[model samples]
Target: MRILDRNIIKYKFSFLLSCLLLLSGEAFSEQQRVSLRWKPSQGAESYLIELSEDRDFLRVHHFYKTKNFRYEFNSQDSKFYVRVVGINADGGRGVSSPIISLADKFAAAPKVKVERPSTVVASSEELRISLGDPKTSGPSSNTPGSPNSQKQVPVSTYYRVNGGEWQRYDGSISLSQEGWNEVEFYSEDILGNKETPKKTKYLKDTTAPQVRLIGEKKGQSGLIEIKSGAELTLQVTEEGSGMEEITINLAARDGSGAEVNLTLSGEEAKQPIKISSSGIDGLSILRWEANDKAGNYIQSELPLLIDAKHPLCVFAPTEGKLREDGIYYLKENGLIAIRCEDPGTGSGLSKLEYKIGNGSIQSYQNPIGFNTGIHTVTVYTSDRVGNKAELKIKVNAIKPDWQKTGSELQEK
Candidate 1:
């Protein structure tokens, strides 16, 4: 019976010792670890950890974790509970703290606000817009983790002119004309937060085209002469807007202002105005009036001197002896050089007028071919500037070896 009692006491003592060891192991394990850990769910990798006085969602303690969390809590304060939730990532995940105490505190979530562009002006040429802070009316502070913050949101602008199509503007866009217009702008942040639509209206177009003349003055006389049976010329030009047409009205006037009108036509053409008469010879005034399609005009006048006269040539012999031989022959080919000038002061010789003996009146510049004989030569000259001269010559062609046949022949 004594052995049985001793064995029973040993067994009881062994059981109590095993219980103490198990309890101590559990206490040490609890001291070493304070929180739970798990792989974050999809879209919930980055999380915000919140501490509360209790799990009832009543009095919030602090923002425990603000960045991506591999949660582990080591705190030594009044016992508190925490819950963690992801903001942007996708997941049905939530973690809560088994009430604990911690020495360090967590920061709270930052407050968020938005800023917009001020006085955006829209035009057909350009859109001028500026951004300012909502609080200070200056550049918005974009510091990380700040409450009043903004991202340089990629914005696309669109424009509609008087209910026209909305053209998208990637950066800056220009307006086309001067008037009121509506503009709509869209902006989105990296976090998928979108701004409300912005709109405005403004004026545009502040320029004009330059213009000038390419040719001479209006109504100016061209470098052309006017005479009976002659053609007149006129030149006109316009620098800008191009030359479309030129109309010219030409007229012939007598001393009494009685004029006959003629029409000339061309679209930038070098036109020739014609004049003719029915044998009445007198001074006439030729006038030309010109105008461009742009309603510009100019007038000019030229004095037309007219005369009707036939040319005549006179012949004169130089100081040379005539041969006594009935067949006159001299040492050299003697010439009856003729000088002809126009007799009419207002008309010109159309060509050099000449005649040899009783031959037909023709035109010649140099002397005509002459044989050893008594020949008569005449020439006439005339100018359009009202000038004339005439000359004639008699040539006694003789052989170099001939002498006077008789004194009567020489005297004659």
Candidate 2:
């Protein structure tokens, strides 16, 4: 009769011999032999090997009866548990050794790490990669002849940039590309275990934001002339790292007054703003600075002169001179013309009208001629923004030379 009770066999053996896991042939090759060896028992003639997918050994994967004390097999998965039992020649089973997990004793894959910037940058930066020991979990067996008991070091590190050819990592890498970049890396240990490939990404921006000024009334002599309540627009754009902030400084050109400073966000800076001449009248300088997310900036200045007052009007003789006798003498073609100018900054003349003594109002396109007597001229003018000015001038003029000669001949 065969003795098959495992309970009787468990108490019959005093101690189970220590087990050893060894690897033969190439480290990670397909034909590598994963062997389990143990000390021979006194009354055992053959050994029984049992490999299970679970730790409890409830589900046996492989059962083999061998005459030798060692068993060799190829591992299809990364991890499993195995146990060995001593069998007597009478078909009776001896004590079974404790189940050992292959994952706790096998050589592990190397760990790879890539270091790069986390934020957006304005220029190229350096990238570096390193290799380290693989991480392990659970309590280590720390038994003699165990793979985890010894230290393992990575032998090589490999990397690729932007999906290009793979290369061994030797030194620091530079991200010189203008746009987005990607780097993939892996490490191999001395045991020929390769780590899973890892990827990292970053951005490199070398262009600055574009700035433009619009909605100005006119530009002249390195200055942008505007009315009191004119609209000025500042436009800024960036394609790479979007816009960040814009700062505007308005200071008096003469450097004798305080400055008016304003700040705007990326979205708000693209709209039009009103420039009031109530406080900042006369000549002023508008300096602006625009910045992007990549820490790149552009600075510029625009000279501005605010015109807030009405235009000045005056009447002057074109070809006549005032005599000592309180009368003004002029040639036959002598005439008086209206001259108009802005009081502050120039907003340009919009309307210039004049009337001779109680005459009908007329646009002042040419100089006005008067009869041989004292006369009064009324002038009215306005600027582009409706700033008006009116003036009245008294002029004393004599007849022309030809008229005076005809009068002398008539008297003779």
Candidate 3:
């Protein structure tokens, strides 16, 4: 009785092994192998696999018998209605898996694009790259319930730097050093078919552009004379990249300023530029900057002083003057035309003031009319830079009856 009971328990345990479960399935391209795996049966001796077009095996295409819990297909099988059945040595049958399709399980490889900048300044530190996938009109064997627009994910990924050993890539990576950096990368499909390895070189630079002032810049005080609306061009040299932008700034000694944006097209870009100093005067600054295509940039500046030259006051009054006295003697109704001129400061001459004898100072407008009896006049002129010049002369405006020459009216 005891022996019979032990044999019954053994048979029950063996029967349970037939309830093995079908697990995962993987497929690659038509040139690669496909894999199907299942959970191990507890005490089963072997397993049976079938590929078909229907769940009931009505249109079975292939049959497989093996001792292990897994099976594999070659490049020949396009699709499968696959299932696995467990069997035990005691002639027991356990569970059977539901129907499955091993069709359209592979995807195309991922495409990659890389961008590299070779400027020494304001450039990215990483090796810039973008990913892409092509679209084609075709048929596939993916899951029926899944979306058709899903992207592909690599089963495995790897990379190499500077012809070094290949390493598994967990995520993204970067290039730390400047200059040329060589890289290689690829990924694998579910069936372990690796995509073609891609190789390329990336250029990295971090140097600023070289800048030099182009015009005649010669003076002990670094002095410069700028005309209004003048464009000052500078010679710029760049390595590893082309030019991008240029900027100029003019400001007063008190930090007041205006900025100028320069055009980089039209001419060869090497031609001289006119610097505009119109309406600018006194102590100021001339600053310039240059930028390279890769974002590298540099700046240069110098001190500027405005000196349009002093205004000249010509006291050539026609009313009265001894050719040798260099002084004017005028009648009460006589007129004196005043001329003030400045050729130096870019800034025009501003104020002109004069006084008649002991009268209050008056801003000069047109010609002057003299007062009677040996009047003294002082003329003052100022330029844009605050330069002032004064000339004094003695004049006498006598009444018509006074006869004011060297006679009695004292016209001096």
Candidate 4:
């Protein structure tokens, strides 16, 4: 027998497995049946088939000799590299065919498409996915068959959300979580070839941002008071999708109003938002509005009283006469008291307190009486909106004039 040229045998071996690989696995089953066929080569009496997990074929998994040109086997999610060699009449081996991988003969991974990046308020999020291989064709490809062509008919698909149990994918999936969502999916072809599992993430924000309004002081009747030219600020926060915008609507008692929208980006968003009280005074309303990236919104209103004057309090003796030196000379059994007043358009008086020298402070509900001694008194007062004042007074109650006159008469 003439020795065949190495290049010629290699070229002839290339066409030896014409349309040799075919996958005929059961529907939705793990056991897959694969079929292989080849053309007869000249001067060959039988064929040799080799299967391995490695490309170099150093670790051969299976070897078989047959006179026929077709073979069948069952694969349980196993991939292989295959080659064919020709046998001479005298039992000599010919050049081997080029290596081929079962992976190239299998379908690709499934494709997933999200309808929306995130769910907004009153809106639904839909997820659409396909089991067909993107590499073979877009979806459910109908490509023609050839020696190198691969069959990519997808049979079943499975998916899980947020680490839940695996469920068969039949239709669109809905996302309902408040924030980011985790999803995993995979598919199997008719050849029982399982695709590598894939993971994806998306958002589902549906809550609005939160806002806090801060003022100089708060008092009874839900009133917040601030001084003229005082700067005010608001604290805005978001839990999902982040803050998108902040707006302030200011309405004054004089029927004038203004609106301002804040920019939330870079260094500007980090800075405190100051609402100036430069020209507007008296009672005014501040309306705060905030929104998140998912279109959730919230609004609130704050009532402010802008006053520049401090409240005033006075001390007097109920049963005594005021002397020229601003001191009070009390008669026997005399009492002292205090009074507080507010300036024009100011918050009303809230509290009054007094204390003797080095004594604990007491709320002034009634007149105060001192012992038979010269004493110093300190008084504190405040208005409804935190305007405060203090006063100190001297009282002479050690020896009343009436008591002295009685003593002098007794001496006579």
Candidate 5:
């Protein structure tokens, strides 16, 4: 008999729970009062209502118990989640109702449109958007304000071309599908608000001005040895939005103070600018900007590999005499240096790191000499393109031969 009673109780609880969840989720204005209503459960004597801002009822903000099926809630944001339960006269508790948010309780739909980037996507493919309509008061996006000053902000959803996955639109929007593509966009705000979807149609052209450079930037990747000057010629071809103008500027990166600049405009732009690598060697930056008739522009930059030769490195002691074992003896202490030079390049020798005997590696700036000790000098150097050379020489400072001879006679 007890088992039968337990089963009966469970069935009654489940029945009431179902009734609570079956209520209408939307808010209705009755007698000028906003409220939610539901049908009463069969065996329930009273209903329990729960409301919260979160989908999960863990942080329920309001709780109500009443005999009537209708429940009035205090919702400031008009946005909330709700659930209900029923309690019977026999102490049977019904299941909880399915949770629903009230954010759209009294909101209207929205209309979106493509506002900026000139409606057409020729110059740029990215889109700027704005929202319209959905009547609501208090800090709303539609409130009266300056065209530049916005009173409220809305959450936007982006539907890229080809019915792609939707994402929150953070002001700037883009269409992945180029050419003529149909993209959808919409916006919605909290507090019972949302907008309808608006489709945007446009075209995208991403082609830039074509470039034809001399030597084709190939077959010169290995060791570059240029004794004389290198002449560069360039040609540009553009279709659709014809080229308005083109300019190129070159800057040296080796801190050798080298620069090249050129600009051409209008019908006189057919002639290519001259680029002479006579003095400007090493790594150089070449920037080109081309403007079209449709107010569109293209910018391009390439690291120019100028034709130049590596510097010649020679180990000639500034002041020392050659001795045995590749060692040079300095009669006294002074200075000595390894000479390096790049005859044709603009930026000359790039690297000059050397390691002296039992000493840390240092950049060879000026001449190097020992105060009073046997010295082993090993130097490593290279040009901008990594043309490397190494040299090792041992040097020593010794007493003068006259001093040694005089000392020997006195001792005898």
Candidate 6:
């Protein structure tokens, strides 16, 4: 009986030891894989992952699953109970945490960075620059095999002109104007990482041609006395590029009352234009116009009066008809007279040229004789000032025969 009791006790002890070993084996098998994964929920909605130690949820490990289903947990903790909750598109929560232990999960999230350009200048000609993806920083992605694994990110740059409108500039554009121009650059990574802030730079230019008229202002008017064969002078200066050429025009009122053109030859800035008036007559006004290499223009009018006067005919009489006998009697009478005067310069009438109705012009000294017949006599006279006068006359040539008879009767 004693032997039997000892055997039963040993058997019980063995069974108890076996049950403890089984429990130990199950505990050892529960060692977590250190990785994590999950089957996406219905409708491809994202799932929220959480980790905690006590079932009461003292500390929660939160993770967002996008298109990816696997995540690696890097925490050194040996044992951690994980749970997943369904997340809706509207940020609404559907289910509370359903416990899942890391004992069987696989995978973890990798580190990501971004890249960008070193220096952004106002004169840079790049249209789009790639900031790195969520991997490397600073233009490293422009190289091959970089963390910026994807194609370059499209970048847009804008500029302000003197604090004015924001103008977009493409890659390969160059700055033309010089001023306090400001440029701002923007870039976005493939991973949706936008440049934290825009970059800016200022440009300055202190070089440009200085232009001025050396002798006169634009639209200046004054007497311009140039020798008959001398050149007219115009002084123009440009500090940087210097003056190119000059132009002058003899502007005058034409016969049709329009501004007529007369171009002067050999006109250059800072140079003289030799002009002569010996053969030129009746020029009313002269003017100078100038231009520079930059296409800027300056103009001045020369108020020059040229002396060119000529003799002019001023007067001639208009009336009178007489009988043939009266014309005959005037021809018989010696004294022939008519009133005459000079209008211009009012000088006395000098030598005269007389003609009667298609007759030859006859030169006469002062007094002239006329016949009796009805005569249409015309005379042209001149004064000392080269002005001319004209006169026409009808003279009575016949005397009454009754006057002769009455004298004869008185003698009888």
Tens digit per residue, CA lDDT, model 5, 277-332? 56665566667876543234556877665635556777666668777777777766
The CA lDDT at 240 in model 1 is 24
Error of 6 at 285 (Å): 2.9
lDDT value, residue 303 of candidate 2: 75
lDDT of 6: 0.38
Say which candidate scores most in TM-score: 2
What TM-score would every model get versus the actual structure?
0.26, 0.51, 0.37, 0.43, 0.30, 0.25
lDDT of 5: 0.54
Regions more than 4 Å wrong, model 5? 1-206, 216-228, 307-310, 315-412
Over 293-407, each residue of candidate 6 has an lDDT whose tens digit, in order, gives: 2223345665543322223332211222344554423433355544454332232345567887778988765555545455577777654324455666555544334344333
Candidates arranged by lDDT, highest first: 2, 4, 5, 3, 1, 6
Displacement of the residue 382 alpha carbon in candidate 2, Å = 4.2
Arrange candidates by TM-score, descending.
2, 4, 3, 5, 1, 6
What is the lDDT for 244 in model 1?
24
TM-score of 4: 0.43
Name the runs in model 3 displaced over 4 angstroms: 1-122, 125-154, 161-165, 180-182, 189-192, 215-218, 222-231, 251-274, 297-301, 310-412
What is the lDDT of every predicted structure here? Answer: 0.39, 0.60, 0.53, 0.60, 0.54, 0.38
**252-328 per-residue lDDT for model 3 (tens digits):** 66654444445563234434555565555556777776655444445688777655356776765665554467656
Worst 10 residues of 3 by lDDT: 1-10
Candidate 1, residue 61: the lDDT equals 46
**Model 2 per-residue lDDT tens digits across residues 93-135:** 8777767665554443222231323324333222222222123
Candidates 1 and 4, the one with greater lDDT = 4
1 versus 2: better TM-score goes to? 2
Error of 4 at 385 (Å): 5.0
